[model samples]
Structure formats: structure tokens, C-alpha cells
Target: MKIDLFITCLNDALFPRTGVAMTRLLRRLGHEVRFNDAQTCCGQMHFNTGYQKEALGLIRKFVADFRDAEAVVAPSGSCVAFVRDLYPKAAEWAGDEELLREVRLIGERTWELSEFLIKVLGVEDVGASYPHRVTYHPTCHAARLLRVGDAPLRLLRNVRGLHLVELPAGDQCCGFGGTFSVKNPETSTAMLADKVHNVLSTGAEVCTAGDNSCLMHIGGGLARLQSGTGVVHLAEILASVETVNPAAVVEPARFSAEGLA
Candidate 1:
């Protein structure tokens, strides 16, 4: 099947390797992956920040970009969640029946990376091998919004030489709600402190999550504390093979709040 990648704005700008790794993983599984340069943000930031009117334009653009694809796969759970859960409401609020129909059609085909890999592709093991102790942080959208329960963990479990450990308070938000981190700095920092503590407690060398946004937030705090823990996206881990080590698959750069901002 021909799959269109809806590389979210954050992944496009901040974490380009995540998108590349996702495409590599899909192609390795024998699926043709296409990237539409016309694709832009899914309007998740605007919609979450109470700018619905401005978000409508992006929502329409997203539909136009991937409307023809047999399947639309995104690496970011939050962006996919916005398209699947909010676009229909945005269309209704605009009173555009045509847009609403288009939104429903496109939203139905949009799937989070793990969801598509397990449910549609029906493959738990992508023939990945990563010799490391890894702990997963279930991002809010992937856990709560997408409800992709155990899909990511199942894939991780199948990786060769991968030790998957349960994260304490794995379901808690990493305090990176896009604008939420900016508007309420103190509260965000406090929550981030707790998340960092939990990640350190895992005793894992690497921390992995479905969303880079959360990884950015959690990874940034870990960096500040001078922790040895590294953060990687799930796609990057799953894309690893015996021929290509996970470390060499993507850049070894650690995320920082300065870079993200």
C-alpha cells in the first residue's frame, strides 16, 4: 500500500530524523512511503491554544495534502489526535458541510505510527535489534486520546536485545502541552521535575516516547540535570537493525529548551 506521511511541524522542524526513521521503518516492512511537501502543521497548536479560526486554514491544508493517499501515517500522536478528534468539530463550527465531510474522510484514514504498525500492518516485530535498556513514556495523546494501549510496548518487546522496563507513572503527562508549558511556566517546571525524577528512577540508559514534543520536554530537563539518560523516538528504535545500530540511525544530539523554543 502507498502510505502518505503526515510529518508534523515539530518533527519537520525540530526532529527531522524521526520522520526519516518512520519512513525507513515503513519501507523496510514493504510499504511505499510518500512525503507530500505541501503538508504542513495539523493546526494542533492553534486549536489547543484557543485559536480555532486560525486553525481552520491548517486543517483544510492538511486534508488537501494527504487526501489522495491510501493511508495517512503520522509519527506524532498529538497531531494525529487533533486531526481525528478536532477537525470535524472545527468544520462544524465553520458551518462548512463540505469541509466536515472531507475532515471525516481524512481523519478516518489517519493513524498514529504504532497504531498503524500493529493494527493495519499486523506486525509486532519489525525485525529491529537494539541492545539497550529502554523505558517508554506514554505521551498523553497516544495513551489518552489515541488509546493505543500496549501497541508500542508490544513492538518494543519484540526488539532483539531490548530490555523494556515500565516507567513509574508512565501515563502522566510530561508537562509539555505545547502552549501549556509556556503559559504556566512554574507549574510546567514542577511537573517536568517530577517526570525527570521518574525517568531517572527507571535506571534505563535511554528514554523513549511516541512524541518528540514530550521527549523534548523530558529530554531537556534531563540534560539540565546532567543525567546520562538519552531520549529517542519509538520509530528510531524500531528502525534499528543488526546492520545499523540505533545510535547511528539518528543523530546523537540531546534536545534542549533553547533549541525547541
Candidate 2:
């Protein structure tokens, strides 16, 4: 099966290595992957931040990028959730009927990384091998918006020498609501502190999630408190194999900002 990666704007501009990692994971599993360079923002930031006009163009850009592909996959759940769950609303709000029609069609085909792995790919064990005690923080976008529902957990359970620790309040958000951290730092910090506390309680060396945004938030809290735990994207884990150590797969240096840029 040939898959087209959306490589969301964030990943394209900042974490491009994630796109590389994602493609490699698919190829390692014996599938063809293509990175359609035409892809851009999914209109998520604009739509979520109430910039309807800016979002419309991005919506169309996303549609054109993967309209002909077998499946459109993205590493960030927030972007997929925005394209899948929020695009039509943003399109309709733009009062452009034709655009809204196109948006609806695109929404039907997009999948969050985990969803694509478990549902479209029909396999959990991506032949990935990561030796570490890992726990997952279910991001609000992937967990609530996409309703990913244990797809990630089930996949992690099958890995070799991998101890999957259940994070306390696995359903809780890590308090990284895009611009929420900036608008309300105190509340964000408080919630993130609690999230870090929960992550550390597991004694896992790394805390991971489907959405890099949440892991960034929780990971920062861990780092600030000098908790020694770190954050990693789920795609990195799924893409890991025995020869390729997933735990050592660090996000590129350019993506070191913890999701603010």
C-alpha cells in the first residue's frame, strides 16, 4: 500500500525528521511511503486561533496535497483532528460553500499516526524494538478529538523487552492546548506540573504521546523540575526496530523549543 504523508506544517518546518522516521517505519513494515512536498498546514493553528480566513487557504493546500493518495497520515493528532474534526466548521464559517464541500471530502481520508498504524495498516507490532519502561500520555486531540482509544497502548504492549507502564490518569491532557500555555501560563504550569508528577510517579525513563505538543509540555515540566525523565514522539517508538534503538531516537535539534515556536 502506498501512503502519502501530510507531514504537517509543524513537522515540515521544525521536526522534519519525524517525517523521515515515519516513512522509514512504513518502509520497514514493507509498505511504500511518499512525502508529498506540496503539503502544508492543516489550517489547525489558524482555525483553532480564530483566523478563519487564513485557515481556508491552508485547508485547500492540505486537500490538494493528498487528494489522490491511498491514505493521508500525520504524526500530530492535533493537526489530524483539526483537519478531520474541525475543518468543515472552519470552512463553513468562512461562508464558502464550495470550499466547505471540498473540506468535508478531505476530512474523511485523513488519519492520525496511531489510527493509520492500527486501522489502515492492520498491524500493531511495526517490528519496532525499544528497550525501556515507557508510559504514554494520551493527548487531548488524539484521545478526545480523534478518539484513538487504546490503539497506541495496544501497540506498545506488543513490543519486545518493552515494559508498558500505565500512566496515572492516562486520559488527562498535558495542558498544551496550542496557545493555551501562552494565554494562561499559571494554569498551564500548574496542570503541567501535575502531569509531570504523574509521569515521574511511573518511574519510567521516558514519557511519550501521540501528539508531540503534549509531550513537549509534559517533558518541559519534567526537565524544569530536573526529574530526569524525557519526552519522545510516538512515531519514533513505532518506527523503532532492534537494530534501530527507538529510545535513542531524539527529535532533531531544531525542534528543541518544546512546541512554542
Task: Give the alpha-carbon lDDT of every model.
Answer: 0.87, 0.77
lDDT tens digits by residue: candidate 1, 135-213: 9999998888889999999999999989998999988888989999999989999999999999999889889999999
Q: What are the TM-scores, per candidate, against the unseen true structure? A: 0.93, 0.91
Q: In model 1, what is the error at residue 140, expressed in angstroms? A: 0.5
The candidate scoring highest on TM-score is 1
Q: lDDT tens digits, residues 1-261, model 2?
A: 877777766666656567777877878888777766555567777777778787788788777777777777889888888887778887677787987887788778788888888888789887778888898888888888899999998889887778889999877767779898989889988888888888889999888887777776786687778777777788877777754433343545432222212
What's the CA error at residue 237 for candidate 2, in Å? 1.0
Count residue pairs with overlapping backbones in model 2. 0
